[model samples]
Target: YFQSHPAIQPATVVVEDRAHPSTSELSPTWNRTDEWYNYRSNPRERVHVLAALDESSYTGGTMNGDHPIAWCQDYQGGRAFYTGLGHTKESYADPAFRGHLLGGIRYATGHTQADCRPENGYRPLFDGTAESLADWKQAGPGSFTRSDDGTLTSSGGMGMLWYPGQDLGSYSLKLDWKMASASGDDNSGVFVGFPPSDDPWSAVDNGYEIQIDATDVPEKTTGSVYGFRSADLKKRDRALNPPGEWNTYEIR
Candidate 1:
């Protein structure tokens, strides 16, 4: 599917050994033969991998489903899009859903016409850089360290980084993300319309958080613009590569 879709390139791909179930799937009494699980559970490794992939392909998001749905971000600002509507053969044949996916790709890849209406206009502020890390400095009291494996890790409460010097008054901000797993509440998401001085918590209180948590309540999963509106993702699948794999995300 990727090779044929030349307009969309595979940025950072992960081909994990699928012969075994994830550690979360194994019982404690089982042989416990998977050492890879230990390596994957390391936060520093995870962040490094995420940052590396993000830098390489301009993709930042998770794919928790069993099927391969491309999560992508636009290099330009103002739109983030995801479509979990690719699990079934019938869905693959649905023109409307396919249009949505293609539209998202076009928007992210810089091929779509922009809708400049106040409510729909997107003005990109941050382009994802080492300087962007400065925004998180105010997040307060978190350790930022590179692991032996070269992944960046941050522990403690939530932190955030946003494009500085902009107030998105009436633009639409889209985020595409997936949970790291099918169970447990390992939540992560995009924070939108936040004040430059604010942290993730303030964004949650004043702005909005479009949740990517699949296990969250239906109102909060996939396309939900956290606490405001819900995306109508009718079907669900869990064929995504395990947690350590790269998932694409687009936030406009």
Candidate 2:
């Protein structure tokens, strides 16, 4: 079906092998160990993929580890796609699943990209700047310190520093952020498509938050389209690096 559709051509596919010990090895108990049994050796591995999706529901789950569940880094000015949905034969055979898969392929292949910018727009209030850090006074005592590497670090508050002189709606915004640890709650994100507003809270309720929490229960973890969608990736047992170790995240 994908080959015949030129709109979906030029695609890339990834498959995870359960037979591999890293993912296939079984533990005696489900609760104590970080493995699920029923779907352990399913030829297709459907259960494993579904479990990852289900975990994407809250905040923290199997994703708090150092390893990334799954990722796609090839950007060619088209759509980027991923799916932890290749675990079972039945899953592959399902029409609904196929439809979504095909749609993603088409979109990623540049068959469809939405255009939704306002003709006359509001200017952004906080262009990421050293000065914008001053407005964060009321968001609950936070401090910004210049790192040896020149990246500004903030503690105990929530705010955004827009890049100075960045024109809205023309260029895409990208940045890397990670939690200080793997088990505690950390709140931060790159706010995009923000409308000029007096406070950051306005952006929280209005714009899109590319969430950066490393300890969110499940559905709210790193890479999640906060409150709206989840990244389709696998669950891996890897811990985030120690505090002060930088983890790079890019959003465009």
Candidate 3:
């Protein structure tokens, strides 16, 4: 019935994302006694994670080392929020806890707003539209299908979508994507660090690719900087949403 199980104990809460209204008024290190619960999975990139539990501060930490205690997500029709606090009857009596609850409520109900956007630095390159693709140059075979809801899906891509307009050195790139395949296996990658070339193979030779296919070996799978560095599978697997669901990737 629950993905996270609870434990009645004390914890030192640490603010992970401080820009949010919920964590703005609270102290950076909050020491409180509450029934902390560890989720079977983490909803990191899937939500605006306001705060997290310092695993070293307590036990029953089943979420490996990374645990998200407070997070909020913008749903299809409304917003949803979850916190690993407020288990005991005396929790509501605490003024700091009450303030935290009020702040969360205000942001959820649109009574106040915060910059809930993910990936702090980086301008949008392609906004999931065919129109946005004008800024990009397609080299080689296959194409990406632009959907009405603003998602670009790979059609038959042995090709490359290259942003010829800019030469990036130190910058962050972020995009939200979902594969159509049910097996959680798809073929695509966001290529980087290469010069503008009409031939996509040049990027393959000189630049780097962040793999999207999950079926490959760890070195070449999703979150891997193809052939160069392997992602920390333990952390990557915990952070990933299932394939058919929209997932946000922040490439720095």
> Which candidate should be chosen as best, given lDDT against the real structure?
3
Span of 10 residues, lowest total lDDT, candidate 1: 31-40
Candidate 2 error regions (>4 Å): 1-141, 182-184, 235-244
Q: Which is superior by lDDT, 1 or 2?
A: 2
| Per-residue accuracy of model 2 over 1-252 as CA lDDT, tens digit each | 011111111112211211111222111111111221122122222112211222332233332322122222234443344444444455567554465456446434544322211112223233234465454433324556654332456676565554334446665443334355555366777777766654767678887887667666445666677887765434211323323333434355
Candidate 3 per-residue C-alpha lDDT over 81-150 given as tens digits, one digit per residue, 9 for 90 to 100: 6677899988999988887888788778866545455333345676545667788878999886665545
Candidates in order have lDDT scores of 0.39, 0.40, 0.73
Rate residue 1 of model 1 by lDDT.
22
User: Sorted by TM-score, highest first, which candidate order results?
Assistant: 3, 2, 1
Q: Against the correct fold, how does model 2 do in TM-score?
A: 0.40
Candidate number of the best TM-score? 3
What does the lDDT read for residue 105 in candidate 3? 88
